[model samples]
Target: MNQKQLVSSALASVMALGLVSGAAAADDNKGKEKCYGIAKAGQNDCANLAGTHSCAGQSKADMDAGEWKYVAKGTCKQMGGLSLAEAKDKTAMMKK
Candidate 1:
């Protein structure tokens, strides 16, 4: 292949590799569930449904009952982790 064609082919291969790796990472969490009220401050996996923050590890409070992290399915409750609904209710109750 010509120089230009070789560069394009290499770039395409790199992009395909990135896509494949990302898909694999996502698949790794397929059977996981989001467990709330268990993440320590600045250690959350993502933003809360309550719109508290916009990124991971951005929680301002430890066990805020709003943030969540991915845990094995059916294990959240056993681990004393709350669901989104339960967390929200608990937060509401705490405010009163």
Candidate 2:
């Protein structure tokens, strides 16, 4: 194939792969809930409620009451974690 066509094919392949992976991740979270105050240090799923960071695995402390991870729905409380509302309250209380 021509060089231009080859590059175009490669770029399309990469884009397709990204879309597929993103869809898979979304499906994987279908049955999960955001459970706060349960993630270990450096194990959070995404940004903390405090907005100190905006990526996964960026938590600086264990059970910060602001960091959260995906857990099976209905299991957060059983796991000693909090829902989003509860987590917000706990985080607010911690600032006092």
Candidate 3:
């Protein structure tokens, strides 16, 4: 194949790999709530990010301190929240 063709193939392969890996990671992270958060006023819940599992408080604070959009209402669900593996197991059981 020509250089351009070769480069195109390589890029496509890398992108596909990235997508697959990302999906896998997300699957692995299922159910684990992000640890960090400032919590919303009187809500008793914090927005936990899906990816890093980090609480939304820090992210929200970085995005905008006063904006109400930063806060998503709801508790982490579990008592203190489950780890990724635990969450996945719980999810699997629920599916059954």
Candidate 4:
């Protein structure tokens, strides 16, 4: 192949590898659940329902009712994890 064609082919291969790895990583979380009110500030796994931030590790407060961390599915409650409704209730109580 020509020089430009060789470079393009290499880039395409790298991108495909990245996509495969990303899919595998996503599969790793298949049994995870979003456990709210358990993550420390700046340590959440993803965005919250309240849109406080759009990415992980961006929370501004500890135990944010809206923020969540990934936990083993069906173990959220056992781990003192608050559901969205429970979190809201706790927040309201704290405010009162």
Best by lDDT: 2
Residue 38 accuracy (lDDT) in model 2: 97
- What TM-score does candidate 1 get on C-alpha atoms? 0.68
Alpha-carbon lDDT, every model: 0.90, 0.95, 0.44, 0.87
Number of clashing residue pairs in every model? 0, 0, 1, 0
What tens digits encode model 1's per-residue C-alpha lDDT throughout 2-92? Answer: 9999999999999999999999989999999999988999999988867968899899988878889999999999979998889989978
Provide C-alpha RMSD values for all models, in order: 3.8, 2.3, 12.0, 3.9
Better candidate number, 1 or 2, judged by TM-score: 2
Sorted on lDDT, best first, the list reads 2, 1, 4, 3
lDDT of predicted model 3: 0.44
Which segments of candidate 3 are over 4 A away from where they belong?
Answer: 37-96
TM-score of each: 0.68, 0.78, 0.40, 0.65
lDDT tens readout by residue for model 2, 70-89: 99989999999998999999
RMSD of 2: 2.3
For residue 42, give model 2's deviation from the true position in Å. 0.8
TM-score rank, highest first? 2, 1, 4, 3
Give, for candidate 2, the lowest lDDT window spanning 10 residues: 86-95
- Model 4 TM-score, 2 decimals: 0.65
Tens-digit lDDT track of model 4 for 1-96:
899999999999999999999999799899997899888989999887667579999998887788899999999999788987887787778778
